[model samples]
Target: MKALVLSGGAGTRLRPITHTSAKQLVPVANKPVLFYGLESIAAAGITEVGMIVGETAEEIQEAVGDGSQFGLKVTYIPQEKPLGLAHAVLIAREYLGDDDFVMYLGDNFIVGGIADLVEEFRTNRPDAQILLTQVPDPRAFGVAELDPSGQVVGLEEKPQQPKSDLALVGVYLFTPAIHDAVRSIEPSWRGELEITHAIQHLIDASAEVRSTVIKGYWKDTGNVTDMLEVNRTVLETMERRIDGEVDEASETIGRVVIEKGVRITNSRIVGPVVIAAGSEVSDSYVGPFTSVAENCRIADSELEFSIVLRDSSIRGVGRIEASLIGRHVEVTPAPVVPSAHRFVLGDHSKVQIRS
Candidate 1:
């Protein structure tokens, strides 16, 4: 089986940061969100992979060259615009050929791997198998309505009034049968060929459309809050280590990993915190659930539950919590200002003063 990962999308929700980098490349625990999906595909023993890229194609290509580092061979498929999920599949028809492929969203993070689901799909050989999970706001996502027997009987994308609370997860498994479905459906009102519509077409045609309800942690990481949350979740499972220098004045606690070339002096770090290589923490308090990326410098500051990316500096910051500082940025305390009372006694007729 092969994998088709969608790495293209105009990440409007994650602006500012997405304005500078691809949303798929957002770091969770200092690792790109796209890498997590790629790793999961590799773990499932799927090596032949095709990546769908859009406007930020060059950036994605530079970061993920041939996919050789991840034990998979990657082929770049360019999309002029993000028409829709179904459009991605339509354009990738040549790369997918006649093989069954798993479609994954690069920016999505599913805690567990897809091995189990892949096994189920291979065993049943369903025309299409989709993962669903209960979401608080179903209207914002492509929702699925189930029948009395819990079968997916209806599908809607970003509806005003959702039919069910079960929303589609970012992972999908499909056989070559889906190729025909894509061509059969026309564009939706939004002028894009939504995958939900194509899947509905298959359902209408009596195709074997199966659904699996996932209970594990999953996130699209489309915004700052979700990015921070995913980072915290991944950090919770990290192992403890001290590979670099820690001065006698420095103190390390809990599950902390100091990568090689990291240097800590007179700082107190409480894990699960990760200090990447070439990072230096001096005279600071590095609190829990934080990741200091490579070449970053944190001096005379206090940080907790934050992610400081490569070459960034946070010195004399007083205190910072729950922030995503981008690469090569500098964060320091604002200048001090004096507060005093000035006297102005000039009114002659009816001047009133209270002290």
Candidate 2:
């Protein structure tokens, strides 16, 4: 089986950051969310991937570069626009051919990977198999309705009246029989051919469409809150390893990975934190669940439960928590003499002040 990974959506939810970089490329725990999906696919023994990309195709291509790093041969499939999940499959028909394939959303993170799910599909070879999870709010995701016997009966994309709390997860297994299903469906009111509709078509046609309600951790890192949450979740499993220079005045507790070339002086770093290479943290409190990327500098600040991207600097800022800082950005305290608040924020930026 092959893999079709969708990396083309315009992430309006993660505005300002997504405005500059691909949503899938956003880092969680200092690693791109897309990388996790690719790694999962590779681990599932899928060696060929057709990466569906959009406006940020060039950036994705540069980063993935033939996919040899992940033991996969990747073919870049350019999608002029992100029509829908089903539209992606429609265009990738040539690359997918007649082989059974998996469709994975690049920004979704699922703990424990999809190796078992792939094996289950291989054994049953259902027409389509979708992963579902109970969500507090099902209106924001595709909803699945099941029959009394636990069989999938109906599906809807972001329905106003959800039939169930089970939201479709980003990973899906499908056979070549899905080609006809996509061709048979019409675009929804959202002006896109949603994958949920395609799957429903299979159900209506009496084709075997199965689902597994997963109890594992799964998140769509589309917005800042979920991104930070996924970061914290991944960091919690990290092992403590300090390869950098920490002066006598500095102290570290818990699971912290200080990459090589990092220098920490007079700082207190809590556990589940990772300071990447060439970063300098001086007179700062690097709290838990924080990921400071390579070449960053943190001085005289307190940061916790946040992700600071590469080449960014946070100096003299009182505190930062539950945030996602973009790359090459600078965070500094305002002039005390001004006695006025000032901000140079980008479009769709959200900031909360401690009045």
Every candidate's lDDT: 0.93, 0.96
Instruction: Give the CA lDDT, 0 to 100, for residue 140 in model 2.
Output: 98
Clashes of 2: 0
RMSD of each: 2.6, 6.3
Task: State TM-scores per candidate.
Answer: 0.95, 0.95
lDDT of 2 by residue, 1-355 (tens): 9999999989999999998899999998899999999999999999999999999998899889999999999999999999999999999999999999999999999999999999999999999999999999999999999989989999989988999999999999999999999998999898999999999999989999999999999999999999999999999999999999999999999999999999999999998999999999999999999999999999999999999999999999989998899999999988778457888999999998786
Off by over 4 Å in 2: 337-355
Please state the error at residue 206 of candidate 1 in Å. 0.8
| 225-251 per-residue lDDT for model 1 (tens digits) | 888889899999999989999999999
Pairs of residues clashing in candidate 1: none
lDDT of 2: 0.96
Query: Model 1: number of clashes?
Result: 0
